[model samples]
Target: MSADHYFSADPAAPARPGTVEFSVAGRDYTLAVASGVFSAGRLDTGTAVLLRKAELPTAATGGTLLDLGCGYGPIACVLATEAPSTIVYAVDVNARARELAAANAEALDLAGRLRVAAPDDVPADVEFDEIWSNPPTHIGKAGLHAMLERWLPRLAPDGVAWLVINKNLGGDSLHTWLAGLGWVVSRVASQRGFRVLRVARKTA
Candidate 1:
């Protein structure tokens, strides 16, 4: 990884152009990428795991969806493509990543259903039916926890969040921490040392 953080507001590294190709739900995608973005070299392995393992929405699924830490909008595009009626909010902190995500969404003709925004740009009133993220654990435990604390509450009642974490990077600890916080956390899948956690509000 480059010294320039992918989560930086304005990446200092010079942008290097490229494309990342991947398939999801039997659909293929070739997205634009640049240096200083998260997993710019390819569709991140954790992201691919999350997308394949999580319960994808169908067209009948009607509600807002959130792709937290959306890097170039692969999950956002896939969700929009799968559930055309659902509005997908693709949020990230990096300007370059957001720009690339927006461009990719447009190129895929999913601009109408996908909204690529910065962390602070999402409207306060929106409540997501589902939140998908392969969060930036490199941000450190405190930062990662804070990010989750800030966003998980935005989930609508009965909503769920799908997350993929590298086991080496506090995946099990995160599962424990979420449970400690009174959230319902379940390990839905484990592949190549990555844990796919399905989290939801604890119910009575």
Candidate 2:
């Protein structure tokens, strides 16, 4: 069995190069991909759903956006393209994924606006104007919750986060959990067995 998880810092699988093409908001993207990375053979279904369902940034949106667990820069690249004035932080724990994401961003001419880095490499005080993620649900409920706990607080007071979760992977429970954490979570969309969640800080 393949011991490779998308979270593996250095995936040992052989690098099999490929390309994944997808369209979002009427824009088409063909990003270079390779083995040993998340969804190397194709654009991930969750991410595709997230992109299709979530509200993307506008051309005038000018602020820092966070793409948590950025596999190969799809979200970051799209954000950079859609919101040229905004800066995108593509963060992941996997080194190879980071490399691939950086390369993709550069290939897309988004390197100037996209910053790819490991989680700890992101500056502590940097708050995000928006966050986009299709979290690794296979990491288990506890791990997923911990991941959210670490990043969700970094959202600016008015910032919003768009997330895609498998309905069978604690999606509804996560929504309830976020509400318990004082976040205003809403199910913005549901399609192809996935749930799109929009989360924001609750105003008291």
Candidate 3:
């Protein structure tokens, strides 16, 4: 596999643009996608599980949200649509992925609510009221942990983060690891070999 694919800051692969269709919260989506981005061909299984099993935001929900490691802005689009009152920040390291994500949001008419940006481009003062992700586990354990450490702290005091991880890819261990880091971790669901975890800050 090319190091430039999916996880790199700038993938060298051709865009080879395409579209991926999926449903969440009884709503259907057809988002723009391309080669060099994660899950270019279709909606990834782990992400499908996450969207299906996790408690999605409702129309009444209102706050700044996050879609970490957002590929072509699937989660970000869904979150923004589900909670029209909220704004979603979609963060990714892959330049091509960010481009595709922004384009997808624009295509879906969610550009006003969903903001796509490179990881470091997010404002320092911004905090998330909720976070959603199907992180890039292929990045390896250390890299994954570092990515989480970088974003999870940005959650508001009462915020929650929903994550889905492949069981064969150390899902359970990741749950334990988050607990060891003093975050409250809960296994919300398990389906199709994926673990849906709800993570939050420890309360007083």
For 1-204, candidate 1 gives per-residue lDDT tens digits of 455789988898789989999998888999999998999998888998998888999979989999999988898899999998999999999999999999999999999889999989899999999999999999999999999999999999999999999999999999999999989999999998899999999888
> For candidate 2, lDDT tens digit of each residue in 1-204?
356678888888777788899998999999988887789888888899999889899998989999999998899999999999999999998888898899999888999889999999999999999999999888889989999999999999999999999998888999899999889999999988899999998886
- Model 1's alpha-carbon lDDT is 0.93
Score each candidate by Cα lDDT: 0.93, 0.91, 0.93
Q: TM-score for every candidate vs. truth? A: 0.97, 0.97, 0.98
Which residue pairs clash within candidate 3?
none
- Candidates ranked by TM-score: 3, 1, 2
Clashes of 2: 0
RMSD of each: 1.2, 1.1, 0.9
Residue 73 C-alpha lDDT in model 2: 84
Instruction: Give the TM-score (vs. native) of candidate 2.
Output: 0.97
Question: Which segments of candidate 2 are over 4 A away from where they belong?
Answer: none
What RMSD value applies to candidate 1? 1.2
Model 3, 1-204: lDDT tens per residue? Answer: 687779888887667988998888888999888888899999999999998999999999999999999988889999999999999999999989899889888888889989999988899999899999999999999999999999999999999999999999999999999999999999999999999999999999
lDDT of 2: 0.91
TM-score of 3: 0.98
Sort the predicted structures by lDDT, highest score first. Answer: 1, 3, 2
**Which is superior by TM-score, 2 or 3?**
3
